[model samples]
Target chain A: MAETKTYREALREAMVQEMERDENVILMGEDIGVYGGTHLITDGLIDDWGPKRVMDTPISENGFTGAAVGMAMMGMRPIVEMMTWNFSFLAADQIIQHAAKLRYFSGGQVQIPLVIRGPNGGGVQLSAQHTHSLENFYGHFPGLKVVAPVTPNDVKGMMITAVRDPNPVIFLEAGALYGTKGEVEDGDNAVPFGKARIACEGDDVTLIAYGRQVNLCLRVADTLEEEDGVSAEVIDLRSIRPFDEDAIVASVEKTHRAVAVQEQWRWFGVASEVAAIIQDRAFDYLDAPVERVSGAEVPAPYARNLELAAFPSDKQVANAARRVLYMEEK
Target chain B: MPAENGNGENGGAEARGEGSVATSADRLVDLYREMVTIRRFEEACQRGFRQGKIGGYLHVYTGQEAVAVGFLDSFKEGDRVITAYRDHPHALLLGSDPKNVMAELYGRGSGIVKGKGGSMHLFDVERGMMGGYGIVGGHIPIGVGIAYALKYHETENICQLFLGDGAMSQGAFHEAANLAGLWGKDGQCPCLFIVENNQYGMGTSVERTTAMTDLAAKFDAYGIEHEKVDGMDIEAVLEAAERLTEQVRETGKPYAVEALTYRTAPHGAADFFEKYRSKEEIEEWRQRDPIGILENKLLDSDAADEEKLEEIKGEAKELIDEAVKFADESEQPPIEELYTDVYSGEDEYTGEA
Candidate 1:
């Protein structure tokens, strides 16, 4: 059974459910308790769980994030809010040095069941320092599990899976889509990591993305269908590190044409990985080279027009899909 | 001996006020033995590093033996202990098998943490030795978090966080200390910050590193009560450890103790230049060596004679020799182990299948 819920509500419900089920599960972040989360993803949680469980930390990202790593080692499932993914750079040492490598360095003696979640990517013109898409940055580490779920259902379900996983999970939420509503399953509907969800199936060409870019791909799929009479399959790569290579290969094997999309800069982005994987695995299929639709290589500007120009748009994705489909770009 | 002539006038036992727990002669002897064992073990490590038997950066807790030995004496079951890269002494004091510790330095399969951590990251969780972190000030927050969890779980256990004098400059230390103090107010953080002010950080002395040389007083910024102790004196450290550990356990509040000590050996095994300070300065500190002071105290108190001290030294040598032999004989970790332990579940490895 399922009900329609906003991405924020679904995300909060997933954490609340897990916290209720497991006493070890707790939330910690700046302004999460008394101030209600900056994004309100954890709003009203302090009243239910109290200050101990819903901890409000100081503006020390390195300290609290490292503390969460320690708590996770001691068997507490701490979900640390990074306010935004941009601030995570301050705690990158803790996340990369300690949280990621602790289990390996400790010879499997400890497990960091830590979930560091926050809004990622720029949409509301928060400018340079405040905006970032860090999936590729974190996914490069071997010990971390990186996932960016766009849908409310996937947000709720993936969060459940992330909480239960015995490794550190980097949850990249679509900051722009917290108010976006979708069908969310009730109760423990945990979606497993390392699997791709085929958002829309088609036979001609495949459109691949994750986070908010998944919605952009769907929109591009509609435009492609109406304008070029081309069928575009949309694949949401929900997980990045434990990537669904088989799903990508299978989708490419069927459609024979693909366009990898991301809101990150072109250099060393997730799209680059996707393109490399496609060429390595599904080269036998007679299709054109995979096209990568990525953001312009520049820091996000404060102006709305400049910001919109910086990110991947429907037109850019559609043209990329059209180019792969061997059709004229509109 | 130069040590006998220098620092010999410093009074022992009667110097500090008597606490409820009177340290017995037997306990003093035991503490001396442990300190000597650590000294011998560290000396062996230096030899092993020079011979290429032990790889990576080798940081020995040579002259700073008494600090760990004294502080760890109050370690109770379930209390967690964590420290920086110079960690063999902490692990050994917490009862980690010396063979495994030596084997780890040798990069062997049967080593503690399975040869992955080397000298910098020794972890014996079963013995409450959380880990030996490599980064300066990085483990502070983790230690505070462990204390928070201890309180969260409604346990009387506390976490003993060992940091170097250099780490005080890092933002992580200040941030974690603030959190410790904040949480301690509500009886939710039972973290004991033990700053081992061992004179120098690598080659930079504490005075050169910070304008404020008093590292313990720095804790005052976080509102945590703190004190200083002669890290060279085992009795002083033991006295402070027993009383402070009890206070933290009872109140679940964070506390700080700056143990002023020195590393008589070179910063690293490869740091042979000795250019940071003069040879005369080294000689001066050597006269006040912790082991030498403890030996004088034992001799003056009639706790043991020269023969007893020699026997203890001989025993420590034999034990360390055995550990070295075991480490040399141990096997390297299997190739498959490279892919293991990256992640914990069914899909344990993310690399090539």
Candidate 2:
């Protein structure tokens, strides 16, 4: 029987299991020890493993982040939390300049088995400063692996793989999905990165997304099938850096149309990359231009109504799918 | 507070003539030879830059050789070293192959980093030389992190992080210093912060950059032990490094050493105007040149004759000549190599997008 668990529980399970497996695996971040993390995802971990393993750090993002990179080089696996993805800007130099490019620059003499993870995407009125969708920002770099797992199973499985992988990983967790429940397989369910999960199979149009947007795409696919009588295929691009272009191309070939979605701003966003890949590899199979549904181009506002409008919705995803299928108005 | 003389406890008379950390007469001669090699290698770099053979920013370690050599001399096995862009000397001192170092500057596959890092990003991991970072103050935190790992792994070795006077103003330096100070309390951090106070931060003098000219005093804010050393004197730097490095290893605490020195060369090859400081000031610092002090010490102490010094110079010249020949004869990295090494699991990746 499949075991059901929340995203938060699954993430905590991943860390707890890894720490139990390897003594070198340690967790470090602000409030991660005493307060059990800013999101409470690491709740009771400190009590379980003590302060040395679940380290509590000061609010020195660049400092702790760079320290984790150094630890990784010395054969220690460090899982550094950013508290929020917005605060990661403080550690961008360490993350991008040092962590991402160290192994390549060092000619593969060093391997950074480091994971920098935290909640991302704008929702719940976090406003401009607190909210960010950094998949595109992190994925743009070559050496780093960027993974955005949508479900509890994917997050738990991918976290295991990320900790074990001998390269730095940017694990962008969705804050809104922490409480979302999903059926997760127990015991050694490590998911391989760069593989896209086909959430639903259809023939009319392909709905592509990742992270929290995958849930929206799944819901939209159902709506398209029931209300609009259109069968929409949904593809969850779990890993962004090692992009699953073959899976996307194959899905687009079957569907004959595609609609990319992202919570980041429209310009130069993850959707832009997805649309480009579809066009590049599945150009002949397309009956119409691939439509893109992305977050509005504005700093995330504080107001509830405005914040809701800032990000993509099921309605928007369904409309974009219709547009890709040439069934909705231009 | 003004910068005080670093050799008070050790006594300048004993430390200056005979290094406190057992600098045998032969070791002093060897150190002098290493310094000479760095100077000649950088001079070759200048000529190569003029001829358009070496591309990108070339920041040489001509004036601050003693800081790298003296401090690195104290490094034991398993000790890791990280520094900023003025890195050729550090790599050489830490045992990076001269041929690979020169070939890296030439962007050849035979270079230490397979010509990918170029001048600013030299790395010899096997020798525990972590990297030569391009960004100012960027490697400071990484240095602290390395120390944390060393302690966490229950290793006895420490990490030496090198930054410049200009990097003192960066937030990363302060943040890293604070973390080092905090982590050191638990005996989990053994990192040494070495600031190469080369009088200028790429044209901005130390005096103009900060109200507090004493860079060592800044470490007090982070609760780290701080001191200033006479960087021009190799013996003084070695004495300080020996004391501080031992303290770091014994206590597992971070320490800061501000080596007061001057760079005779411009910040980079492109920065030639020397408009930032007066020529008279330049000539004055040049008199206290690190190589000159060691050479004079070697001569005055009767450890070596002028002929012996010249012989060392000739050996360095010959080694540099071989480095240049190897770099010139080395092949360029193939176009296919550009795609490799980005990710570890190459076979698993399709390289499709």
DockQ value for model 1: 0.86
Off by over 4 Å in 1: B1-21
As for candidate 2, its clashing pairs are: A67-B145
Q: Give candidates' CA RMSD values in order.
A: 2.8, 4.2
Q: What is the lDDT of residue B334 in candidate 2?
A: 77
A1-330 per-residue lDDT for model 2 (tens digits): 459999999998998899999998999999998987879999999998988899999999998999898899889999999899999999999999989888778776788889999999878788999988999999888789999998999999999999998889999998889999999889779999989999888888999999889888888888988899999889999999788889999998898899999999989988898888888888999999988899988999999999999999888888877777767632
- DockQ, prediction 2: 0.72
State the DockQ of every prediction.
Answer: 0.86, 0.72
Lowest lDDT block of 10, candidate 2 chain B: B1-10
Candidate 2 TM-score, C-alpha based:
0.96
lDDT of 2: 0.88
TM-score of chain B of each: 0.94, 0.93
Highest-scoring model, TM-score: 1
